[model samples]
Target: MAGKRGGTAAKERLSRDVIVASALALADAEGLDALTIRRLATDHGVTPMALYWHFKDKDLLLDGVVERVLEGVEIPSYPAGSQPEWHVRLLDCFAALLNALNEHREVADLVHRRFLGSTAGLDIAEFAFAALQEGGFGRTERAEIGVQALHNLVVLVTMEPGERALRDSEEEVARRIREKKVVLQSLAPERYPNIIDCAESLVDKPADEGRYRGLGLDILIEGIRARAARQLAEPAEKAS
Candidate 1:
C-alpha cells in the first residue's frame, strides 16, 4: 500500500504549468481572495513548500494566472497578401481577446494590468498594433488606441449585465431580475421615459451573448475606423 501510494505521488509530480492551471481554476470557481498558496497546496495534496518551489510568493502566482489567461487568446492570422481590411482584422483581434476574457471574467482586471508583462499578451498587442498601422494610425496614436481598446474590452467583460447573477441560484437570479425590472419600470415615465423603455434589457441577460459582445466590438472598431479615415485625410488637406 505504501509503495502504491508512493508511485501515485511520483506520477503527480508538480510543475509550474500544472500549478498555474490549478490556480486559475481555483480563481475562476472562487474569488481571487480565496486563491492562496496554502489552499493550492491543500488541493494538490502537497505541502505549501511544493507550491512555493514553483512560485516564490503570492504575487508571482497571480502573475502566472494572468499569463495563463492571456495565453488563451487566439490571434487571427492571414496568408501573406491575403489579409482582409484593417478594420476587419482589428475586429477579429479584439473579438478573440474579448472571448478570452469572457471565459475567465474573474481575472479580467488582472489581465488588464499585467497583459503586457506576458509574451502571449505582447503577441496579441503586436497583432493589434499592426492592424492599427495598416489603418493609418501614427506611432503616438497607435499607442493611445491600443491602450484604450484593451481597457474597453476589459470593461465589456467586467461590466457585463447578469454576470454576477450567474453565481446565484436560478430562482434567486430570476427574482432579482424581476425586482430590478419592476423598480426601473416604476419610475415616472414622464421624466424617465427611456429608463422605463429599457428596463427589461437592463435587468435581464442579453439574449445572445455573442451578439452583445459583437456590438461592443463594432462600436469600438467603427470609432477607430472613423478616426483613421480622418487622420488619413488630414495630411491631404494640409498639402492643399
Candidate 2:
C-alpha cells in the first residue's frame, strides 16, 4: 500500500515552483525548522531524491524562498513626463515592500539577509536609487540611505506587536496579551510611567496596523528628505 501511495504521489507532477511554494507555506505556518528536504518529500508523497532534484540543499532552498517573497514587491512607476515628488514615489516603493513582508513575516529575516542577492531585490533597489537621485543624493549617499531604509522597514515588520504570537491559537494569544498588559500595569508608575502609560499599546495588537506601519514609513521618508536637503546644502555652504 505504501509503495502504491508513493507511486501515486510521484505521478502528481511536482516542480521547482511547486516545491518552493509548499516550503513557503510550511515555513509560514509551522516556522522554518519544519522546512526540510525530507519533510517536503513526505508532503509531496515522493522520495527525498525528488526534492533534492529541485534544491540540492536547504540553503539553496532558502534562497528560492527569499526570491519568491521579494517578487511580490510592486516597484512603483510614474508617467515619463508626470513624475510625482521623489519622496512620494520612494514612500510607495517602501510601502509595497512592507506589505509583502508583513504578509509572510515568518520569512522576513531570510528576506532581509538575502534581499540583495535576488533579481527582484535588485529591481527594487534600482527603483529606489532612481528616486534618491531625483532628490539630489549621490551614489554613496543613495546606497547608504537605501540600505538603511530597507533594513528599518524589515525591523518594523519583525518587531510588530503580537508578531511572535502569530502561530498561537487566538484564545491563547489573547490570554497572553492580557497577562502582559497586567504585568506592565503592575510596574511602579513613578519609576516607569511611560511603560505603564503605553502598556495597552505595547501588549495588545495595534488597532490600526496600516496607520501604525504608515507612521513608521513616513518617519523613514522624512529622514531621507532631510538628509538629501543637507547634502545639497553642503556644497553651497563650502562655496561661501
Put down candidate 2 lDDT per residue, 20-74, tens digits, no spaces.
8999999999888888999998987778877777788999999999999999999
Writing each residue's lDDT as its tens digit, candidate 1 over 72-178 gives 99999989999899899999999999999999988888887898888999999999999999998889999999999999999888887763643578888888888
lDDT of 1 at 13: 89
**lDDT, candidate 1, at 209:** 84
Locate the minimum summed-lDDT window of 10 residues in model 1. 3-12
> Which stretches of candidate 2 lie above 4 Å from their native place?
1-12
Task: Tell me each candidate's RMSD, in Å, in order.
Answer: 2.9, 3.0
In model 1, what is the error at residue 179, expressed in angstroms? 2.2
The reply for model 1, stretches above 4 Å from the true place, is 1-12
Error of 1 at 24 (Å): 1.0
lDDT of each: 0.88, 0.88
